[model samples]
Target: MTDDIDPDEELMLAAEYALGLLAPEEAAAFEQLMARDADFREEYEAWAENLADLTDDIAPVTPPPALLNQIRAAAFGTAAVAAPQPEEVEPPATAPVFETATAQGRGLLQRLGLLPAVGGGLLAALVALWVIDATIGPSLALPTATATLVSEDESLVVEIAYTDDGEWLEFNRRTGRAPEGQDLQLWLINGDRAPISLGVLPAAQTGQLRVPEDYRQLLHGGNCAISVEPLGGSPTGAPTGEVVAIAPIVWET
Candidate 1:
């Protein structure tokens, strides 16, 4: 199989397969070639590993509510499903625990939080092992640290994670939204220093924002606050409106 195709073409095909960008029929053919050619399989695996590195610091994002319907419509050529009214769940009246799942079974964002509501030391150890074995291997340091911000009334909840090496912060807004004509602005509060505006939170539930190299160091041991400001953000270059929620950054170490 390897002899019949040009070496460079085979390498390109391997990369396409690794990225899942090949058409179904072409992918099946590539898989068959991979099974029969040990060298080709190795190339494909290497490509897969290299491509995985590109997303190491990327946070997992929750899909939109209508994504399932769009997927169904695409694959089955069926009409979209009727939207169901979401069941209202009451917020916990007590202090926000910042966790809902067990350490081992949590999703990526929750696992990266290092189990803020649970035993932090144990979960941090477990997560370290998992990250090394599963993703970036041993070459990279633990990629990110996490924190959870909850409003005083627990009406708003957000999970924030930042990577020192990548100089980016990922946010997951678990609940709540900005009030009418207002926006949620994320700010970094480091000691007596004035708050540094990360940016206005997006309407989407989850997203990432780039951080300056100087600001990355401040994320650890510092605090984050979300303030309700005008549509764009605070006009004063600082938090000029009511701060809705604040939380301390929790590092994996």
Candidate 2:
């Protein structure tokens, strides 16, 4: 392969293939070469193995006390304490109103408290590539990956997290929603693969959706998107309307 193709260009193609940055036709051509050429196959695998190592360096961030309390409340159905009467003194601001949640949801929140909007896009893309190329083990008990999908016009922002063990995904709509007559549908995109419907997002600010068994593995380095569709959802099986928001699914920790 290097004899006909420039060695530098060959390596670059291998890296791009490993990252899933190539278009469908391009990826298909590359895969054909890999099937016929042992050297090219080794080169692509090397890049894939190196990319998967990125997950090892991720570290979780600790949220502020108040924010932690809110996460706990959302994870569990813990109600906020009632306000003090006018005649009575209020409790200290730092005091906890609800017991800390030790459930799986809380575990996911702890790792996902401070994900940046810009960071991890590449990591997520590369991780998706790694997932496609490598054999990943079973899902973890708690998910640490998350994505914040924002529209180009900044009209919408949705936070997404997936729990492979539970086979469910949690979404928190921080801002924006469908127009009065429309509903927002969620789609999961993995590399050059076709987008899979996660279904219409709930109107509620926070909710969970059960994921099908096959689609669970695709969430790690995939992307979640929200598109404006008809009242119930897309009439077509696929997205026929404009995609309003999109973001890469990434590790929070």
Candidate 3:
């Protein structure tokens, strides 16, 4: 697909995506094209993470006991299922009774943590090789789910990702590959009333920003947006830009 993106259009889309606010079809379309349009992805990621962070600030009130139980039931189900059994483990053999000189070495070996470690090392290597071959060979593409973030101008890209998991949305203002003086900021919009401030995303070249486990609900449902604001961001809570990219979080199969 043609990437034909303007900084402003992409930014609004990024916010919607980060807010977990996009309709399923819109999100899928973005994800399918993001690789070719990474600028879009990057901005979206930052916005989503930013908003996801704001929701993080509000404490998730504990659902009452009954509600908690109900949630668990809905999540886990009441169907009868067989329990998983533990794998049988063989016990180690008793140490050898050897000559005096050999006995001393064996005694030392037992004292050190080497005997079991050697066997474990071989087992670990085998597992590692198996995992690498299985996971690496398939060439699994980035997730169909995509996230997009934006700068205040709504065009300068910041970060993006392909998962609802907050890892992709964390890139803050490290450096701007865009025009001069434009840095990325993050925000959470209710899409109902207005947007709320989360905080500056982490700088570039850093790892994923942790999703505040606390405000997870916002990531699941809300119209999130990224706007082009000042270098620092809005002094007020409302958005202040051309809205470069946006993505709305919606339920998808």
What lDDT tens digits, residue by residue, belong to model 2 across residues 24-140? 335434543554566887897798789979878888776555654444434433343353232333334564432232212221112233222222432353344334222222244
**Could you tell me how far off, in angstroms, the CA of residue 163 lies in candidate 3 after the best superposition?**
6.9
- The per-residue C-alpha lDDT of model 3 at residue 93 equals 35
Name the top lDDT candidate: 1
lDDT of 2 at 211: 85
True-structure lDDT of candidate 1: 0.62
Residue-level lDDT of model 1, residues 78-181, one tens digit each, is: 33344332332332245223222112222222222422222233234334434432322223356456767666466677788876677679999988899999
By TM-score, rank the candidates, best first: 2, 1, 3
Error of 3 at 81 (Å): 36
Lowest-lDDT window of 10 residues in candidate 1?
100-109
Could you estimate the TM-score for every candidate? 0.45, 0.46, 0.33
Instruction: Evaluate model 3: give its lDDT.
Output: 0.41
Candidate 3 lDDT over 1-253, as tens digits, reads 5787656775687676555465433543344334346677678667656766777779777655445443332233321123222231322134222212111111111222121111232234323422332222213343222233333333334433324444444443333443346534455443233455555444455445454555444554333345456676666755554444443332221
Which wins on lDDT, candidate 1 or candidate 2? 1
Question: What ordering of candidates by lDDT runs from best to worst?
Answer: 1, 2, 3
Candidate 2 stretches with Cα past 4 Å from truth are 1-141
Better of 2 and 3 by lDDT: 2
Q: Indicate the TM-score of model 1.
A: 0.45
